[model samples]
Target: MAEKLPALAFGELTDVVRFLMEIDKLKSIQRRTKVLGTDRQENTAEHSWHFAVAVMALAPYAGDQVDIFKVLKMAVIHDIVEIDAGDVLVYDLVARQAIHSEEEAAAIRLFGMLPDAQGKEFHHLWHEYEAGESAEAQFALMIDRLMPVLMNLHNQGQSWVENGIRLEQVLSRNAFIADVYPALWDHLKNHLDKAHQSGWLK
Candidate 1:
């Protein structure tokens, strides 16, 4: 049986605690990317943390004009909506389009778990990232694409192979990197070429 608990206090912090507990749901949201060299796939919680770290580590590579803080914020919250919508691979064209409404609904419910002020802020940040209209969002999107590409390459194109994703699809999904961070795009293209030459890509 589960352990019995003591009485709890209900106060100003209750909403905050509730919000945090609700987000624990993110851990169960599995992503398409795997931990390199492992057969197992990653969950959204791990993806968010790793992406936040990557934002910090790669911020220097982003243009001098971008805000690192905003970029980091985008990385961590971009997939929080996936807790409901689940993950849809970028190459899955139809599902990607279908999930937009699902994700928006999810974002409304998930972020609304918090107090109004915080929830509004969370939703705004998520919307900004999704829009990719600002420099921070653009950089965040680049790293988001680049990280999975790196994972796929290191895993010998595991997901790419499983999904039968093609080189043109990858290039199209990742082309934005060339405009924002050419060096990062060059690095990603190198790995992609290696994957192609190794016959890891079909």
Candidate 2:
């Protein structure tokens, strides 16, 4: 007779399936943007993918030795909490203040869906991204801050103009990234200053 595996055996395969399904929900959480014209509605999945690619593209500028894979995972899971908190505009001061509590609650609920070990692992990754302590997390954040700026610039400040966003607000929102990725920040600031001068930024 074949030996039994165990009374309370849990298959890692099942845990993977559950995590995949939960991650799939990211495809439905749309962001507030009108990029690429026709009022583009980007979902969380797209945003995550964009950041992951950007992290690699900008990796050399990271402050310390960074594991590209960790940065990718960080980017992919960083905003999963936004599914519950909802997408808040970068320039919205009131919404930004409430984001912490709302996202913490959402993180508990969303991450709680996974098997114990898996949930804890992902929660740690998400928290690391938020803390911006690791080199990977810092790089991940730079991309996160850069994406909207790229969108606005590419679309000739379409979203910025619509949202009544000023250059000062955009600069302030991304200022933290300068602490780790000063080169990227410098590049962005140059573009932003030109954009402001040319009436491309409001």
Candidate 3:
């Protein structure tokens, strides 16, 4: 017979479970970026998972002052607000500003579903990621920005072409990555040059 799992009392565990169930809605939140090697658009959940993994891999490059634990936490919770605000394109400056309040409201509601201390930690980490001021936050943001660029390059700039995004726009939006990770930015620029030459980016 299979081992039976123990039941939990209705308290902190229940709150955590409820929060987990609620965040499951993130899987249904679609993004404009397609999954590389396929035409299907990737969802926020997949993006978060991929981001967390990328953080683990790139933590060594984020400098000695950066906290990997905080970076990882920020990665996982950064997009939970999108469960309510939905995914906005990073390049959409106006749309991003317009949704700031909406995203904050969503963060409050979703993170509040947890027990007080846990909720506060998540909320703080989420805000830290958004602020992008701390070393850890900057590192997290760099990887966050890098992922889509890498995906677009691999997928032949599918989303960029479809959205009429220009090379200058992409470079301008992601230029901050150079400040955070110049080596990686240099590597990405090479691929971007090829993409531009191939007319994948206008």
Per-residue lDDT of 83-157 in model 1, one digit per residue for the tens? 889999988989999999999999999889788998999999999999988998888998888888888877888
Reference-based lDDT, residue 167, model 3: 85
For each candidate, what TM-score against the reference? Answer: 0.93, 0.85, 0.93
| C-alpha-based local distance difference test score of model 1 | 0.87
lDDT of 2 by residue, 1-202 (tens): 9998743434766656665676677888888665376766888788888888887887766645878888888887888887788788878988888788999888888888788887888899988988888777777877888898998788887778777788999999899877876776898899999889878767
Q: How many clashing pairs per prediction, in order?
A: 0, 0, 0
TM-score of 2: 0.85
**Runs in model 2 lying further than 4 Å from the true structure:** 1-12, 35-38
| Global lDDT of each candidate | 0.87, 0.81, 0.90
Best model per lDDT: 3
Of 1 and 2, which scores higher on TM-score? 1
Q: What is the C-alpha RMSD of each candidate to the true structure, in Å?
A: 2.1, 6.2, 4.5
In candidate 3, what are the lDDT values of residues 1-202, reduced to their tens digit? 9999875556648989889989999999999999888878999999999999999998778789999988989988999999999998888999999999999999899999899999998999888889999999999999999999998998889988888888888889888999998887888888888898888899
